[model samples]
Target: MSVNNKTVWLTGASSGIGLALARQLANQGARLILTSRREQQLEELRQSLPNSEQHQVLALDLNQPEKAKETASAALKNTPVDILINNAGVSQRSPAMETDLTVYRTLMEVDYFSVVALNQVVLADMVKRRNGHIVTVSSVAGKVGTKLRSGYSGAKFAVIGYMDCLRAEMAEHNVRCTTVLPGFVHTQIAHNALTGDGSLRGKEDQDNASGISPEQCAADIIRAIESNKAEVISGKGMSKVAPLLQRFFPGLLRKMLANR
Candidate 1:
């Protein structure tokens, strides 16, 4: 599970935890194929990495789930992907009752279906090679329900469930699956979060502003990958406690979340 010299295909590599992971993985000598919606930003990130020429950039819009298979195929054509990181996702900051149906659809498309689509595209190759790793970035919301995040929580929950099943299935194949449930990390996710009407929230949440750094999250994620952990929850303080509480005391956790 050593990342050194492994070919890692990472989505959402333009910013946030993805960017931090790209930098860290590059430093660890992992060849990278970076993807996101912003080609310019990906190119800039490539130039900033330790071995700029060793990495490749393929700008992708995960929102377009139909193109995921083709996109993944192209990436595979260039180089066999030893690791596939599904990190491209969006967040929501609206009450479920008031949120538009389109919002839910969009969230599911980008956060859940797209991951499945791309994973399917590369899975056969991984099975054939008998060596591959699949890592997904989920959210604490996936572990527990919270107010103002109905769609976001649902999509992330699906990701966790999907990865869990994939892990069990891939075990005999020697392929590993790691699901990362990150609490409120300091990222632009809040600013870009969808509102009730499907418009961007454009405001940073107080908790997110004070959450763990993306670099720390990325480092923890790399450790989880190397260890081949089934799941890892990364965050600080209460963010770390929330999942434990949810697993041990559901009624109490529900009440606590209701007050949030």
Candidate 2:
């Protein structure tokens, strides 16, 4: 579906891919309900748009899955969510064994549970209307596991599966579900990812540092949404060959990673 003049609710809108998408959507005449934990950043982004005053920003933490329904309800009060972009997520930098339980749980809450919760809350309305689009932002890691990203990959895979199932179920209802699997977009996700504890990882992966920009990622995502594509893989490293190598040529992939 075309994005123009649609009421779209985008989470993680304070920065990175979400922020870039908000800008692009605003320019294209869409009304957006921007959400994130940083109200200041949201406000700044709100002003960056064309008719800056027209956009809306709601500050809410996605870690609290229970709050998703309430947040959706509030957003729908002004404008019903015709399009829901589940772009809010976090990552991890350590292996499952080394990462604290709290860290993993937090990642699960944001990357998986909250997205599911929000989708559940908004879906009934969309189904009743028999029209809507839901875009879920997954990672390339969702398709293939990697070292130091065990928890992150697990959560991404779970969300991807959930979205896939939801898409299958919603096919008859005119609601489209598209899962965007990006390899590495030059976003601040690494900066916000959890370390061993609750602290931010505060470091960008070398590959991510050299990855695609959030603007480019947003553009590709918009194209996918327009075409109602079920799945999309962005970035060079997200190729089908990457997963193939992970399965059959694990040793070679490991050596390549070691060299990186």
- The most accurate candidate by lDDT is 1
Best candidate, TM-score-wise?
A: 1
The alpha-carbon lDDT assigned to residue 244 of candidate 1 equals 94
Candidate 1, after superposition: displacement of residue 50 in Å?
A: 1.3
Lowest lDDT 10-mer window, candidate 1?
71-80
The positional error of residue 210 in candidate 2, measured at the CA in angstroms, is 0.6
For candidate 1, lDDT tens digit of each residue in 184-207? 899999998999999999989998
Model 2, 192-219: lDDT tens digits are 7787766888888777888888998999
lDDT against true structure, model 1: 0.91
Quantify all predictions' global Cα lDDT against the true fold: 0.91, 0.86
List ranges where model 1 is wrong by over 4 Å: none
